[model samples]
Target: MFRILFYRPEIPPNTGNTIRLAANTGSQLHLVEPLGFAFEDKHLRRAGLDYHDLAYVRVHPDLDSAWHALLPANVYAFSSHADRCYTDVAYQPGDVLFFGPESAGLPEEIQRLPEITDRLRVPMMPGSRSINLANTTAIALYEAWRQRGFAAGG
Candidate 1:
């Protein structure tokens, strides 16, 4: 299964939707702290819509903790500034997909970190800022799953 990492995500609905995404795709969702909204945020609860328990969600105190828990895995950090497209990589199971806060994308330092296998972007029309965080995650997740023949999806 793949793992989704959100670094300091600031939005509630997006995270909520992602929780649901993780549940449906059989992926685990890892969240780095200082989140803008509390876990009890009503918007998040409403967006999650009774799927929270189905999702495998883990909260980390910091990036270091996340690394400690998820290292030795192929980490692909998503950034709009990246030259590589999301589809360029041949993703594998156990790979980690990293995303940044909704307001600003992944920090430059994080994007260039040696821990990350590569930085990638979801292709969009010229001049577009970026895609929705949850949507981008779904695209990458499905692409990776598709590459693996959507194993056990039946």
Candidate 2:
């Protein structure tokens, strides 16, 4: 399954929802710390209900650490500024799908990092706020999973 990378995420509810998404989809949830919320699973459970139990979440010390842990995988960073639409990409198992904090998207310097092989965006109506973090992750993950025929499970 593909991996979900939350880069310095700050919102609890967003991570909460993504926890459910990851758990249900058989994707690994990689959180690059320092996170803004606790990892007690209570907050996530509060928001995600019993689905939190299904989550396969891993916390990283930092971006470099995450990269070291998951090397050679194509990383698709989600950014509104990107030119490519997400659905256009051909996702592979172990590909890293990275998203930045809700308050601030990935830093421009980070966006230019060589580790990022591609950047993509979900189509949205002009002047509309970016989609919720969890929803965006869900949309991207499902699209990638759909392309793979959802093969990790029966």
Q: Write the per-residue lDDT of candidate 1 for residues 94-114, one digit (tens) a residue.
A: 999999999998999888888
TM-score of 2: 0.94
- Over 59-85, each residue of candidate 2 has an lDDT whose tens digit, in order, gives 999999999987799999999888999
List, in order, the clash count of every candidate structure.
Answer: 0, 0
RMSD of each: 1.3, 1.6
Off-target runs (Cα >4 Å) in candidate 1 are none
Candidate 1 CA-lDDT value = 0.93
lDDT of each: 0.93, 0.88
Q: In model 2, what is the error at residue 20, expressed in angstroms?
A: 0.8
Clashing residue pairs, backbone N/CA/C < 3 A, model 2: none
